[model samples]
Target: MLTKQDIVAVVVLYNPNKKVYDNILKYKGLVNRLILVDNSLTNNKYLFKNIDFVDYIPLYNNYGIAYALNLGIKNSTEKYILTMDQDSAISANLINSYLKFLNVNDNNGIGALTCQYNTDRNPAVAKKGYVKVRQSMQSGTLFKRSTFDKIGYFDDKLFIDVVDLEFFLRMKRSELSLVRINAAVLNHHPAETKVKKILFLKLKYGQSSEVRNYYKARNLFWVAKRYNSLDMYKGLTISWLKIILLYDDKRKYLKAFNQGIKDAKHNRLGKYYSNYEGN
Candidate 1:
């Protein structure tokens, strides 16, 4: 039986405002421990001092999400680590349910378990059951610490974006399981406006910024090179085709597409930003 001693929740915060802190407090009693990695330099240390459940580790600069997550993993002292974004909120039974799942399905070779994540609407339904996905969002997922020991931590080289995808692909190739728990609920702040949505998609799969373009293109190529499966290649092709047809900004869209191709050819991917400005 997996007890509370087996789990620890890790949240990485970078210049997170009060809302993020408030969100973390909601899960204070649910987990065995809460680990917070503060990647800010404003000396807001005192602000988090009052939160008894939080163990705040301060980094000098913005080390990006992937690096911070690796730091959190290093700091954690539990058998299982639940990774959550600072802005994420979980259901009351999330921790218990995940612990229960882990204890019973020990032979499944499961590296991570993702909850049904909702963004404004019912995004969870789109991803139901114990479906296997290439990437598991860092927020709303519980991971076995031993998984990291086997696959290693999130790739610090990718930095922020697509680190989840990269890690999950590695897990998949290694024949490890990535399960989605439909019962566990997670609420996320979705892109409400059309512009925000465009920007989100662009940054995720487009090439609006040089940095973003580099990563998107590079990562896609890397995945292709490493896996070289027809299914993976087809998925990539279809995704690019959808971006071209769905988004309105033709010039921006084309630019991103072309950049992705160039990066893929040269194997120069890492991270990229969309043209949309709103955060």
Candidate 2:
């Protein structure tokens, strides 16, 4: 029988709501252990008491997701570590299915396993069982402890966004595998709020939030610099250019894009942008 000692779920929470707590409860019986890293400024002691399954590690302030996840992973004592966003809810059989698949295909050099992330009108699915993708979203992904030992922890410099992509890209460069298990599914809440917040985020931070754009732009540059790969640089450049043109508000979009470029050039990252609610 697979015991809780086999797998540990490390979920990083930032001012999490009841929905997050409820989601954790749903998966409580499946994993060997549950570790919750609360990256909130205020102490949520009372809230932590209600969650019997999770071992809470409360941070006084918002330490970027990368930092929080590092803490969770370092503290965990399990063979496999599953890192996820607080907002994500997993299917009951997700963990069991992933473990079974892993056991049978031991030859597959997979560093991480990803589930289908449902967002907006489109559901992100893997083609040909598990395509060799350049990136994987932080939510709904399980990481092999050995992979971290090989690649080191996430870059703390990237505090918030694009950290997952940076980690995955590093694994890709090392020829490690990232598999997508179609049997596992995760429901994600898309940032489909009003156009005002969207426009503000684009203006203030460029295409994504300022924090996200900084990492996206800087990390892309860093990856190209370290790997000396023109293909990767070209792909990211095209993606950024597309975002710049996609916005309805040209002025705000251009301003944010310019700011992002300037920051990227200077390697200014980890600082939160104004108007961004530290997510």
Candidate 3:
């Protein structure tokens, strides 16, 4: 149904490795243009300069995912935009399946479409057909360009964590649909995570650094407060507690959590201005 000419892919990179080039090759041919938004502290243009049909834009600083995505989206003129992470890759068939779904369904009402990600943290769930979801991760997701004109771009204040959730809330309020193609799969490499056996259950604990924990906690609280979703806020709070209890670095995480709560209550959003670094 949809051709390569109608799609543009944007891959956000942050200190990406050589393997990212191979990942780009997987879906580059499926789109008309591939925009690489590098959010690394240093330039990584040399890695993609030789590649064809790729527009590499390096922001010599860590501008965060929301800013990077907005930059890429603003430069593209394609009908559909595929937002991806450097560590994510999708098959050609998956692209065709998404286009086919768009052709058969009411494309106007669809705000965004995402595939079931096959990740190391949790394996993909095999299912037939598609289903509506509350929200989806930014990686391996296809968005309608017009959706932005209707609902506005992602909140730049969010920076990284929970940016997707904040955008989904706006989409929901606008009555735009977010769907997932169950059969289509995106192979994603997750961050460092380990399985820890706590009591009777083996929990997969995320090994995010202290800096990331701050952003996660702060953004989650702010987003929950902004949207007034009590259940969502409660669930995320409980999850964070479980991780702090079962994982190492309890004091650091607890401090970050408290700071995040204080910041959210004061409505202080944007980059963290603390001694800790790295996202």
Rank order by lDDT, top first? 3, 2, 1
Per-residue C-alpha lDDT of model 2 across residues 1-279, encoded as one tens digit per residue: 444458889888888777776777876678878888889997765666876777889998888889999999999878789888888777665686677677776443778887777664456543335444556687778888888998899987767766787788788866788887777677776443323244536322223444454446556665566567575488568647755655456555445545655655666666534433332
Extract clashing residue pairs from model 3: none
Model 1 agreement with the true structure over 50-169: per-residue lDDT tens digits: 888778888877777788899888988888888888888865667766776667776647888887776644455433345656565788788888889898998876656557777888
| Candidate achieving the largest lDDT | 3
lDDT of 2: 0.71
How much does candidate 1 score in TM-score? Answer: 0.79
- For each predicted model, how many residue pairs clash, with residues at least 3 apart or on different chains? 9, 1, 0
Error of 3 at 130 (Å): 0.9
RMSD of each: 5.3, 5.2, 2.2
**Model 3 error, position 147 (Å):** 0.4
Candidate with the greatest TM-score versus the true structure: 3
After TM-score superposition, the amount by which residue 194's alpha carbon in candidate 1 deviates from its true location, in angstroms, is 2.5
lDDT of each: 0.70, 0.71, 0.83
Task: Report the lDDT of model 1 for residue 208.
Answer: 38
